[model samples]
Target: MTDLNARHAIVTGGGSGIGLAIARSLAGAGADVTITGRTLSRLEEAAAGDPRLHPLAMDVTDESSVADGIAGAVAARGPMAICVANAGVAEGRNLLKTDLTFWRHIMATNLDGAFLTIRESLRSMAALDYGRVIAVSSIAGVRGLKGAPAYSASKHGVIGLIRALSEDFLGKPVTFNAICPAYVDTDIVTRNVNAIRDRAGVTDEEALQMMVSQNRHKRLIDASEVGAAALWLCDPASGSVNGQTIEIAGGQAA
Candidate 1:
C-alpha cells in the first residue's frame, strides 16, 4: 500500500488544470481526496466516475465559503492530512494600466485564498499531529514576470506566507511548502495567451511563443511534472523539507 493509503486530502481549484492533476495524483496514491472549485458542475464533472475524488463547491475569494466548505468536507471524510492550496488567478497587467480592482482580485484569490485554506486546514491537521500543506505558487513568485506585476507580487506573497507558517510550526509534525512552476500546460496558460494576443495585437503563435520563450527550456511544462513534485512532498522522508520553495522552471534559479 502507498504511504498515503486511507489518508484524507483537500485540494482547492481541483476541478481542472494543475490542481486537478495533483488531486488525481493524491487519489492514485491512495488518498481520499476532496476537490473544490467555484463551479459545482465542473467539480462534479471532474469527480464523476471516481469514488476517491469527492467534489465540493467553494469560492476561495469568500472566507465564509472556505470556512463552511472545508468544515463540511472534514466532517464527512475526517481531518485533512494533506492540503493543497492550488487555487489561484494569473493575469498580466502593466503597473501603469493596473487598477485597484484587478490588484485586489488577484490578491484575494491567490494570496488570501491560500491564507484561508492553509489556516483552516491547520485546524484539523494540528489535532492529528500529522499534515502536509502545499501551495502552488509560480515562477513569477521568485522572479518578476515582465507584464504581470500583480501576479508576481501575489505569488511572492504566497511563498512569504508559507515561510512564516513553517517557522511558526517548526518541529511540528505538519510541514508547509510552496511549489513554483513556469509556463505549465494548463488552460490558464491558454487563456493568458489569448489575453496577450488581444492586448498586444499579436498573433496566436506569437503570444504562445512569448510564454514559451520565458521558460528556460523554451517550451510549455507538463502538468504532471508538478503533480509528481507534490507527491514527493507527501513522502515520509520529506518531513524536513519545510519552508522551501521548489522551483520547476527548467533550471532557472529562484
Candidate 2:
C-alpha cells in the first residue's frame, strides 16, 4: 500500500523461487529493486525487460562480496530502504550423518549470509530515517524439524537475531522482522522431495505427500504467498510490527 517509487530495495537470491516473487512484487509496488545471486545469467534473466530490476552477482557468504555488491548497488541506484535476506539452502541430515563440513555450510549460507547482508544494508539505510529488514526463515525456526538439525538451527538463529535487533533499535526509524513459512512451493521443496524419496525409499508421490501432510491445509504454499507477506512487511504501515515472526503455516502450529 506504500508508494515506493523512489525507494530502493535489495533481495538476495532473487534469481528464482520466493526471492524472484518478492523482487517482482516489490518492483510492481513501484520500488526500484536490486536482485542478487551467485549466477549472473540467472540474475540477468530475472531482470531482463524490467527496468526497475537491476541484477548484481553476489555470494552472500563472502564478506567482501556482500560488501562490494551492496556498495555498487547503492551507488548505482540509491540508498536501500528495504533489505530482504532470502538466500539460503534447505537440507536435512540426522546427527549421525551430519559432520562439521555439512553443518558449517548450512550455517554459513543461511545464518552468516543474512548477518552480512543486514550489516551492509544498514550502512546505506542509516542515511534514511526509516528502513525495513526482513529475513526469510522457516517453520523449523519455531519447532524443530524431524531430521534437519542444522537447517533448523540456522533458522532459529535468524529469528533470534531479528528479535534482538528489533529491541536494539527500539524507538528508531528502522524495524526488523522475519517470515516463517511452511512447505512453500519453491525449487527447494522439489529438491527436498527428491531427497525424501531417496532417503525413505518411497515413491515420488509418497515423498511429496509427506510434505503436504505437514501443512494444515494439506497443500503446498505458493511462492507468491510468501512474496505478498514480504511486501506487507516492507510497507509503511508495518513499521510497528517489528520483532515478530509471521508464520505462513496453514494452521496454528505454535
Residue pairs that clash (backbone atoms under 3 angstroms), model 2? none
Per-candidate Cα lDDT values, in order, are 0.92, 0.93
- lDDT of predicted model 2: 0.93
lDDT of 1 at 104: 99
Candidate 1: stretches off by over 4 Å: none
TM-score of 2: 0.98
RMSD of each: 1.2, 0.8
Q: How far is candidate 2 from the true structure (C-alpha RMSD, Å)?
A: 0.8
Top candidate on TM-score is 2
Q: Which candidate is the best by lDDT?
A: 2
Worst 10 residues of 2 by lDDT: 1-10
